[model samples]
Target: MTTGTPPPTAPKRSRARTFVPLAIAAWAVLEIWLLTLVADVAGGFTVLLLLLGGIVLGAVVTKAAGRRAFRNLTETLQQMPGRPGATAAPAAPAGGSKGNGFLMLAGLLLIIPGMISDVAGLLLLVPPVRAVLGRYTQRSLDRRMRSAAPGSFSDVFQQARMHRPDGKVVQGEVIRETDPQQGPSRNENPRPPLTP
Candidate 1:
């Protein structure tokens, strides 16, 4: 009889799958409400100009962030102590990718043409906010890589082994012969006598 605690049960509904749709719906409602309020105060023409400006700014920021990320990644790789093509462990924090991702997300939000989304995007562009977000993103990625399956891309860089208590064990013997042309001796297996 086993004395260990029972395994945790999976939830009937996936929170992420459900939460994403709900969050998007909420964002849309909030965006529309904010836009209506802004239009009432600032006039429709001003709101339209603001949206166009935001689009242009978002495009510029996205391009610059992408270029910066590529530059940082190249520099990091060049500084690693290993032969070319060798998969050396990441010498520097993966802040470049994370920052790029957040920046791209912010750009997308700004392009959505909603005052609420634009404000959120502008906040994301702040250096301190990006730094905090980058750290969070890095930790999340590390956690996912740790939990990934064997033979996956994550496994290629990981040096640790995964334990399996129920793994199979095979028993076998290997015999090697130096001479390729020699046959087995008669004592090992005698052949039938020749016909008279």
Candidate 2:
């Protein structure tokens, strides 16, 4: 009579959940200080040009890589079990809605400005990570089904009015009061069946 474990909660992989903002802020201050130093030593034009080039390069790289990775993820998901299938899904790319979401989010994080985030995003985009996430979700579903209460139609009718959490209770009652006309009314005699 053991209850099953609840599904694991969504991982708090959000950037807002951590002290990452402080680190990012520190880096930003350092960048500002470096910019000032460069402005004083070298021509400001050189610094401006370098910054613009970096921005362009970052944008282009993320766009190209994210597009390719997302396509792979989409194809994998389209071929998962319970999906409309023509050919079998490849073994390398795993598939599921959750897997796809994780990959997409990972890609997005990678696009944002940080090396650690990019690496983490790349790992999520990989096929192996998708497989792991999918397997865990499946096992969770299986455990839930196994632990579900088993019941039948008879059990349903027996406890029609009551809520049965375990689905194994037969707890209800049927009051059998005689009809007023068939039995004597309260105002009528309560002796034997009145003999005329």
Candidate 3:
């Protein structure tokens, strides 16, 4: 990858780049290592029970969070301000809805079959931990927004007039006669292609 800037030119198109397999391999290795250590002391069946319990609990948590989010949304809509010249409705309180997204993420992590994931998910379920995480996330986003330039999107290829395959399209100015074929339709004023 070239780091330094080159002379000004059109921007490059974004290319897809993902590390899904690499991430899965690393996560599986760590999880297996941790599970083996736990199993050596607690026995294999106990490990199985823990993993199964985590799945069940994750599902319950996910369902509860969904319901809570829906309820909060309905309440907010009900509290929407009335039409013209009236006092505005009070906005939802600060840190309101209490990070329904984080709760759902916690549930998802717990659903993943790994001890490390379960621990992380459990931590996210705590209110104090969620608050700290929320503040940190907000600050990081604010810093990113402040540092980055919001340049306009590139307009390359926008001037193009995309065409259809139908033969009915006409691409010339109208003549003020009943029929132009009766007179000279010169080569200098040749009609443009019906499709461009």
Candidate 4:
């Protein structure tokens, strides 16, 4: 008596949840391998020095970028109209805040002491790359907002009431009044009939 295709079989485990751990393991392995290779080519002391220098540079960059991003966000908020605790204004354009955030992230990555992360951090510092990433992020956020519930809870209830088969029936009489001097009026007033 069943209709349509059979339901797809469910997996015993979810791949999406496991992907992050697997990726982290792979990244750790790669970092260790690269570090070992570098140590073999350069001495241990040199590698230690490089790591210390990278940490220092990352700290400075992170501090500067964080300050800049905070300033940009503050400026944007100040530029927006309306008083505090009122309806929120639309978000400011993404260029400045997004770029500064990416820069801070890059600095954090550089501080992580991995060649791959350092390279990624450097790439994020590039203006064009940062701008493109910002645009993509903004678009993704817009899409998510668009996909969310479109109206308030009351609106949802009203729509449900309109469509339900067992909804309440409002019985009433509609009276059409006409002026003596003019033609008949089409205006309808719904109310109970007056009693003598």
Best by TM-score: 3
Tens digit per residue, CA lDDT, model 3, 83-171: 34434756654454888888999999889988999999999999999999989998997776566554422222222323433424456
lDDT of 2: 0.63
Tell me the RMSD of model 1 versus the true structure.
12.4
Model 1 residue 145 distance off true place after TM-score fit, in angstroms: 5.5
Which residue ranges in model 3 land beyond 4 Å of their true spot?
Answer: 1-21, 82-87, 94-96, 152-196
lDDT of 2 by residue, 119-193 (tens): 566676677887898799889977765665657444454456466545564545544456867885667655444
Give the lDDT of residue 60 in candidate 3.
Answer: 88
Query: In model 2, which runs have C-alpha deviations exceeding 4 angstroms?
Result: 1-22, 82-85, 94-196
lDDT of each: 0.79, 0.63, 0.78, 0.77
**Each candidate's TM vs. the true structure?**
0.59, 0.37, 0.62, 0.59
TM-score for predicted model 1 compared with the true structure:
0.59
Model 2 scores a TM of: 0.37
> Residue 83 of model 3: what lDDT?
38
| Range of the 10 consecutive residues with the lowest summed lDDT in candidate 2 | 89-98
Candidate 1 shows a clash count of 0
At residue 193, give the lDDT of candidate 4. 90
Any residue pairs clashing in model 1, and if so which? none
